[model samples]
Target: MPRARSSGSPNLACRSATTNCIRCLPQVEWEAPMADFLKLRDRMVDIHLARRGIRDSRVLQAMRTVPRERFVREGLEDFAYEDSALPIEEEQTISQPYIVAAMAEAAEIQSDDRVLEVGAGSGYAAAVLGQLAGEVFAIERHTALGKLARERIAALGYDNVDIRVGDGTRGLADQAPFDAILVAAGGPDVPAALKQQLAVGGHLVIPVGDPGDQKLCKVTRITESRFEEENLGAVMFVPLIGEQGWQEDGRRAASNHLPGASKSQSLPEMIADAAEDLPGFDDPAFGRLFDRFAGRRVVLLGEASHGTGEFYRARAAITRHLITHHNFTIVAVEADWPDAATIDRYVRHRPHRAGTDKPFQRFPTWMWRNTDIQELIHWMRDHNDMVDDMEARAGFYGLDIYNMSGSIGAVLDYLDRVDPDAAKVARERYGCLTPWQSNPATYGRAALSRGYAECEKAVIDQCRDLLRKRLDYAKDDGDAFLDAAQNARLIASAERYYRIMYYGGAESWNLRDTHMFETLQNLLDARGPDAKAIVWAHNSHIGDARVTDMGAARDELNIGQLCRETFGSDAALIGFGTHTGTVAAATDWDGDMQVKRVNPSRADSYERQFHDSGKSRFLLDLSPERHDALRRRLAEPRLERFIGVIYRPDTELQSHYSQAILPEQFDAFVWFDRTQAVTPLGPEHHRGVPETYPFGE
Candidate 1:
């Protein structure tokens, strides 16, 4: 056996006077001032690293010296010296101490070796490498993680360690011929670029296999024309997410295809096999729907169309589970900020306007002012009433920028409460947009006609002013301040969105979604680190546009792609789809709503394939952890139908259908073989009109 640490020893707890993780730990000096930390670090090196066959003194010494606690998130500092891997931002984890020491040992670094570390992660491994190598170049795929790692490394005064954000699969070229390289993420294969960059007698260590499981392999450059590969051992890691590596979830697997259909399955066949049939929405078993969203920070619930009742009901149910069980604090929807503010107040138990027109008075009013939403808010209010802590109660927010005039009024109302002086300045700045606030699009048209926009600087300044006073104003009333600040932000983004809309398509769309994403981020921040949010939006806005024509053909970005890049596995996107159903939509933007019969999905569309699955309702888990073959099969390009507020069925294919790789679009797929229109809340809705076809494609 190894050594047994005494359960009551203080030296066992207190590191040496000159030891590691002292900032967070209780300093109980036995022989010396920092003996507890010292003993702890030494014990970790001996028990975790050395006992695991990490024999190299350099690796052991580096592990012994580096302060691992500095690498972990604030709350996790207490467990910094533990053997297991620790959680970090972006849903990625710092490697286990033993693994870090082993990888460093395998790299066989010389004192003056120029080492390159891929997937820098928490910068813990890089800091260890800095102790062994003269220079360290680290690459992290995510910009935020890399920046954080850089800051950490800099704080440690490790001037030799350089961390940059980029595709690590390509390696660093200009500063090539590294003596050693380590790739922390598992890739499909050892990247060819990394192999080429390895100097003769150099070694490149990487995990090669599926995203979840892999063999830690090392490539040693033998000569100019040859390299040798040795399997170190089996390991698991997050996929190396980038070009020249494993693609994001729902991306195609390199293998599995159809020749004679003997060894392979077609798209519909695969979907049928993988689809998990769901019970009735009211069934107790339906609570298990939250299983797919377990551990997620932001769960985006998508709708095939704005008026689908099943989509509304399903999302409301799932969100309820998340709130009651998981403490989800925010329900952000794709509606204007001012309109949502009223619902937010009602659900949060704030005073509501008694005699006012219900929200979503716009042409697509039924989308939000539906029975489904009414039920959800009523439950939310009940839940809020039961909670003793105000912060613990869930709140609703809107993430759209269509109501510029309303947003301006909200900002003014908020300013009138806290700081009238700043409000006065804001009014003066916002006054310029007063004439055109009612019709922002018209203002945009005029801006386009004049070749210059009015109130651009003024709106931007107003937004900045609110943000500048945020800290001070928040003390007076945090919720009220958030409302005003977000309204101001919506005004700013809306001003630009309306202006650039005439410049053409993608810019306006991108700005709108970006604003939505920012609103979600702000809500989460205000709610604190533990807050979770469920976003309700159209499929087109939440699906990963990068894998669809929205990005490929038109160069646009949506909240799904943004969340995926930022939150990685922590953000779950579930897209809803239907085959043939009755939908609530309009022929023109402001046209009256009609219950139209939706045609069966086109033969080539994924919706059609789901319908062919012979399951009335089911959930498709598109997470990488699911069947690899199924994802690869569905990864093939197929048409996806998107019916927005205005569904023009006369030109169905041209107006609604767009090609996308379904697997790459969402984390999960919720399919209703046939869905129906939402129950509009007011009696004035559902006017019996002439037989209107569904899916105004």
Candidate 2:
């Protein structure tokens, strides 16, 4: 459920590594109190716990009662019930639902009993304990995290659960003799203090072994001087840290214990069996691609990097074929609306609004300002020119929310034309953003760090005003009305977005992707219910994050996974990859553009598997049409590279690579053995970039 963790509730039973780790989970989403979440929670309990042999009725009830999403990272509440653990603050993780259930059951808490949970984490386990026991005491090593856990618990009204910050390995000595003690993190050995703190006849359950490797063990204090230990099962966890556990091991801060791909499976061979040799860009054999996605109304075409020429050319080619023969009318992208609208105007044969900035004028403009993109824009313009009806012509649109200032202007321009009085009111409302128009990020920082007022209400009001006048505006020009309303909505979204980047929640890689997803929805609806669309975005946005670290580990969601839920069989995803390449990118945010050399694919990566398959350029279909054996072979998560507008060769592995199961991450994989950089407008030389860049930004 990677928010396969934007998930509903837990099968939280056996999050593990290997066939072992909580990999390849079936993900779900949340809804009303008596809606999707309750049904999903029951399904999770039945399928991932009870069916797996958890027989404790109390434990099962506790699992079902606690709202795991409340304890999860923000924007990732959707993933609260996934089988896999989700990342939290302090580099810690909320234990997967299965692992928590298993440990809690082993602890054997009873009503009227006092329970202590070592390493409280997100307070998920403690909240569950509060359900079974009369009182629950939770200790966390990280003070800030403990405070957050306390807040989450209190907010959920778990008054029986009390949390504090301290060295948990030492246990709560003054409050000794707890009926049950559950240690969430893995330690080198059982802490003597914890065993001593347990009441006679009580249970102490802890994971014991080397870091990232452990077995859930239940120890029973049978008498004053005797104890019995029993092994539960193999499990993995972050290192237990304290005087009695692993000491200050920063390297173990890694969230997921999922390891590198095992060579035993012979994956490269399996991919070879299903690979389709693709023809060059100009070849008519693109008919193969048409067949692959012929039944799908919306197909997403993704790139390994934003600056690769081959990816751009190929997507442009496939997009061309789709629009020409498959009735595809929309080509949505991972770009800002205000910028893409200029290109949209070009493709739709409408005149670009005077004084509007040309497409991709912002930094890393190379992403859309390249010769390859220009080729597509020119072609789309020509193609639309040949069409009889404007509605039937292919149109380009952007689905990102970063163009705050531009959108404000677009909204104002529209209101001025249709209703001058509303335009004056809009200017007054949008005036709240005047100071930060040059740099919206500073506005968020100022709001958080300097008590600057947020413009959320103003922008939201403007958006509503525009929407309230939708009919009048639409009658003037429905298309323009759609554009204006969307921009207003984007402004409202971006205002909150910029402010929350410094605050907390209402955030994430999720907000941007959510905005993008919603924009796509608006585009499809504006076109019609039966419209066919093609999406062009980075692999991180188009490939299902549920099958990637972005979802399973990072507690993030993307447009790709959203489309899967929204459209099911109606949407298809295809991701591109490269073995080695030269790409145009910036070293840091807003840094100078540079043509960097992309390193060879990591040995454990999906790109490497494709490179080894001996096909320079080919397509591997992983759709339902493929054999189950092939799907099984590629199900194990492996490293996949994602190059954005920024690239860093030295930190490539950590910065660019993310864990992903190829078959589930995408409906198909497109591989290029070697590639070259996109030719940025007015540039043919190398330049120094920035020092640090955001991952997948």
Local distance difference test values of all predictions, in order: 0.78, 0.77
**Each model's TM-score, in the order given?**
0.61, 0.63
Worst 10 residues of 2 by lDDT: 11-20
lDDT of candidate 1 over 1-697, digit per residue (tens): 1122222212111111111221211222222224455666787787656754679998899999998878987666555665656678987888778778888888899999999999999899999999999999999988899999999999989999999889888889999989999999887778878888999999988987653235689899999879999987656567787766766773523432123533234456678888888887777566576676868999999988888899999998888888988889899998888888877877787665443334677657788878788778878988999998889989888998888988898898888778889889989998777877766667776677864475889889888988987799989888888988999999899889878755543677788889999999999999999999999988888889888766764567889899999999899988999998898876644568899888888654778778877889999889896888878667755667887765656445545666678888998999999899998776443345212201011
Candidate 2, residues 43-123, lDDT tens digits: the string is 668756776568899989989988776787776665455455667898787877777888888887889999999999988
Q: Which lDDT value does model 1 have at 537?
A: 89
Query: How much lDDT does candidate 2 score?
Result: 0.77
Clashes of each: 21, 21
Error of 2 at 137 (Å): 36
lDDT, candidate 1, at 193: 83
Residue 265 in model 2: lDDT? 33
